[model samples]
Target chain A: MSLISLALYIFEALAGAAALGILLVRNVFHAALLLIVCLISLAGVFVIYNAEFIAVTQILVYAGGVLVLIVFGIMLSSRIAGKPLVVTNQYVLPASLAGILSAGILIKLFSEQPFAQQPGALPGNPMNQTGIALMRDYVLPFEIAGILLLIALIGAAVTASSFYSKKQ
Target chain B: MEHTLILSSILFAAGLMTVIVKRNAIMVLIGIELMLNAANLNLVFFNRNNPALSGHFFALFVIVVAVCEAAVGLAIVLRVYKYYQTSIPDQLTELKD
Candidate 1:
């Protein structure tokens, strides 16, 4: 295997393990941390695939942004209160069965699809190409994405404000 | 690409397991995030060329949506916790009636 493939394997393993940790870990805080680990390793996986923009965005948006939101969620609610968040064991059998069934389906579908094992290297800097594409061909969607983000921000502020106003 | 797919699927399964098993509302949201991330990984791995219009753009958009989802979801969770004083799924069954 090449060095890049080796890196892919290691990072993928890290992400996979951290994903499992998120599932099984009892503490919500710890689970959130595990999720950060999983996300960061997946960013590494993105890097292995030569998706540097996505890798950086994964780290910035996921690890930096979303994780803080989750951790804040954890802290805001005193109900959970450092308690073990493990689920009831009754779900074990069904969860495992569903997991395996989906895995089988996923593997079957992917096997049918034709993905290139080794993609040709791009001629230009990916970031530059992405910027140009966003500005030219994908401009509408880019603007829509920005608008969606604005709507979400306003909606979140509105939704959360009810409690904030009541507290004052 | 195959290895990445396999790993992504495993991660998806783990996320599904968590969503199925966890009663905590926040934990379920975390599981949902995992599933979304797994999907994003698949998109990035299979992308051959055209980083801008390809999976990269979609992935970027998805990340934005994820941020929105997390913020709104957490806000709603906190609202529920404020009134109900519980974050467990089973106990918050007001809609069941």
Candidate 2:
């Protein structure tokens, strides 16, 4: 295969492995670390696909922000560290069966979908145009996302601080 | 080509299973994050071939939303832990039978 395809394969394998590791690992901190690895590898896949903007954002938002927050949350919420979180036996078998069936269906669909070959070197310089569109055509959704973010921040602060309230 | 999509789907399925089967709140959050990443992977793959940058933009927005969701969800989980002394979903079933 071509060099680009080879690189893509390697990155995809790494990403998939990391994601699976996150699922299997019981330690919450280690799981979060595996998730960071998965996210970074996925960002690499984005770069291979010429989605540089998304690649950077994946690293910035996921690896840098969300994963850190998750790790902190695990630390703050759990009294025990490096231990397996409590697991329930109620739905494990059914959930596994359903997961396998859905995965099979998705794999079938993916195989059937006719994906065109990368046609004539995809436009490598769309970042500027994409930015313009975000600010112009998609201004409303963009602003709405900002407002949502603000509300989330306020909500988190309020919820967290409420824990420290003195009882009257 | 097709393999990438298959892998993404597997990731999504595994994440869904984690969310459904795992009792820990943090594990559930991790599963949700994994599912979101799977969707982002699909968006990036489509953006590779499509001329329009819509998929890429949507992926960007998804990333932002995922971050906000994680922050807020974790904050709630922390509050729950403080009040209930546990983050296990089955144990926090005050509303269930």
Candidate 3:
């Protein structure tokens, strides 16, 4: 096998293992940390696929932004409860069966399909191309995403704030 | 190509299991994030050869949506925790009390 393929394999294995660890870990904090490992390894996988921009965004948005939000959620809720958040599993047999069955079906379908694997390389820097595409062809959607983000920010703030709490 | 697909499917399955099994609402949100990441991985991998960079742009938009989802979801979870004094979904059943 080529070096790139070898690296891909290693990253894939790490990501899969970390994802499994997230599933098996009982502590919410530890699970979030394991999810960081899984996400970073997947970012490496994105790099192997020549999606450097997505890899960086994966690290920035996912590992940096979303994870911090999740950790904050954990801490806030736990403080209210006056205890560490301990995740519990329910319907283990059914959930595992569902997971394995879905995985098997998807793998079988993907393996059966014939994909023309083109090792086509982008001409310019991917980030540059992405910027141009966003500006030119995808400006509408980009603006919509901006609006959506604004609404979400306001909504989160309003929802989380103690504006209408009952007198306790 | 196929390897990436399989990996994404596995990730999706794991996320599904997590959503089903975990009692904590935040953990369920984490699982949803995993599933979204799996979809993003598939998008980037499939469109790697395309010149239009559609998948990359789509993944960017997906990340935006994910951020929004995480923020709003966490806020709702916190609100629920504050009012109910519990974050477990099963423990909260009344729509309005």
Q: What residue pairs are clashing in model 1?
A: none
Native-to-model Cα distance after best TM-score fit, residue A123 in candidate 1, in Å: 2.2
Candidates ranked by lDDT: 3, 1, 2
lDDT of 3 at A160: 91
- The superposed Cα distance between candidate 3 and the true structure at residue B28, in angstroms, equals 0.5
lDDT of 2 by residue, A43-162 (tens): 888988878888998888888888888888877776544454545434878888887898898888888878967623465567777788889988998999999999998898887876
| CA lDDT scores, all candidates in order | 0.83, 0.82, 0.89
- In model 1, the runs with Cα more than 4 Å from the true position are A79-90, A112-116, A162-168, B50-52, B95-97
**CA-RMSD of model 2:** 2.5
State the lDDT at B36 in candidate 3.
94
Report residue B92 deviation for candidate 1 (angstroms): 1.7
- What is candidate 1's local distance difference test score? 0.83
Candidate 2 segments exceeding 4 Å error: A80-90, B95-97
What are the per-residue Cα lDDT tens digits for candidate 3 across B1-97? Answer: 3778888998999999999999999889989988998899889888878878888888889999999999999999999998888878888889887
Model 2 pairs in collision: none
Clash count per candidate: 0, 0, 0
